[model samples]
Target: MEVPPSPTFPRALPSRSIPLAILSFLLVGVISLVILPHDFRLQEMFPSSCTNGAAASTSGQLADAATQPVVDLRVFLGVLTRPGMYERRAHLRLAYSLQPRPVRAVIDVRYVFCNLDKEEDRVLVAMEIIAHGDIVVLNCTENMDGGKTYECSPTSPTTTSARPTTDTYYRLAALADTLRDKPRDGLYHGFLNPCHQSRETQYMSGMGYIVSWDIAAWISAREELRHERGYEDSLFGWWMRKGGFKNVYGEEPRMYDYLDREMGEGVTCFRHELIADTVAVHKLKDRLKWARTLNFFNVTQGLKPSKMYDVDRLNSNMYHV
Candidate 1:
């Protein structure tokens, strides 16, 4: 009778529909959060932790460098000959602390090189330098080994007789004290035992004295401060936990001077113009080398470069050569 009981009005809306819609909306929200470039929670909580950690690790590594000394000068020369060596390279570790609270900091060197010759020079070579920083943290560790170790008392009687029996405990203690008290601003410089020194010289016989040498110099440094006294919460400890080495600032003055002297008038004529054009190019190359080295470390150790800070741009305006 009247439209066949109008298809029984749906008794009730399906119960699952509302829940399903809510679930879909929640899933989309979660996905959006995950896909976003920045995570508010992460920025708020662990903003610079990644970078700081890396720096700390690098700081601690300084001791390792001392333990296993490398032929720095040789390495430097080798790297010079093989520019590829500079690619994905981790050369130095650094530790330091900033002012105010005197928190410790650490950083690692990845790639580093210096360009000595101006563009106008017959020779053009750019040295590349790179480094990785863990994180900034406290340091509170003793150099029990006295910063050196002897596998066993020298078997040779002469060696044993000559060896001072007096323990090095006092010396270690003194070093520890010094490291602890080092000021935040104080800079620590560490050079490769045999730093590689390569000269890429370009000579033009036609132009009587036109000669240029492409040179590079690289080194590492660290800084630490004694903020708190005890072992716990020690600035060095925090530095280690963070990773190590965050940033590096150094100049190989000798190398630069050497290049200038070597190049002489060859690089003088259009120095201003040459510098202006090459500064950016050199920086780009340096950054490229750094990024590559960092990527290598990340892949090998599942570690990443610091995130809390950035390197001050290479000052192209300030030309040395």
Candidate 2:
């Protein structure tokens, strides 16, 4: 047993083994550093792994980009939804006369509401006398179907083409011109004629009066939401109601609230204008004077008088006396 124990295997040399073990550990550490994708500094040593990680990151970035929301210009304009509170504070001007025989005169009025708080948008309006006196009402609702009821058999057509197709902007322009021409009939029977010297006079005149109304537009958050969620049945519908879609009445209340919040309480008027035959220089001059005076702020400077369809060349027939 003692002889056998003397032959026990000799242990490896500590110096050589220690060096070799240290070298093996260093090699593994270097290999891992080069192989790992997270090692940015060492990535150059393993281009494939680095490229894969970069590609993945790029794909993630692309996905995020694709999911980002887009901005809408219509929503920026309050008209996209119900009128905004800022619109109620609009400033309006009224100038009228009852002289020059035939009670001919002009009513010039102008105001800036909402959108114009920053910049102006030109508004070209056109209007035709619909009715007058007790029988006439400013049917601001161009499409008669709005407040009217249609009687039809169950199988009858549900729609009709009797309603007038009027452009709101052009109507405003026309109204502006009419207002510039004083002694014009009032568009609405109950409304006080801005041209009348007093409320009593306006009521008594029965002469009918002209009016000019316009609004500065701004992006409407409600409208934007409606467009986004028109088909959805959730939060968007709730916002649309708050924004004014459910109300059957006109936007007067909304406009009032908007103005009250922005302009503070003050006396305000909503007037209308009309268009005139520019061939009559004398009348045109007078009308222009009224327009300039009423619109002293030049709020209509940016309005486009003509649309794309109006590009046709004018002929002699277009001019009048």
Query: lDDT (CA) for every model shown?
Result: 0.18, 0.18
Q: Provide TM-scores for the models.
A: 0.16, 0.14
1-321: candidate 2 lDDT, tens digit per residue = 011222211221222111000000000000000010111111111111111111111122223322433300000000110112122112111121111111111111111111212122212111111110001112122222322212212211111111221101111222223222221111111122233243222220111111101000111211343123221112221222232221111111111111121224443442222223210101112333334333432333333547653434422233221
Off by over 4 Å in 2: 1-72, 75-294, 297-321
Give candidate 2's TM-score. Answer: 0.14
- Highest-TM-score candidate: 1
Per-residue CA lDDT of model 1 for 1-321, tens digit only, reads 012222111121211211000000000000000011111111221112223333222333433333443311000000111123322232322111110111221112121112233353212222221123221111122122222111111210000001011100001111122223221111111111122421111111100000000000000111122222222212222322222221111112111111123234343211111221110111112433323323322312322345654323322232232
Q: What is the Cα-based lDDT of residue 268 in candidate 1?
A: 23
Cα deviation at 136, candidate 2, in Å, is 29
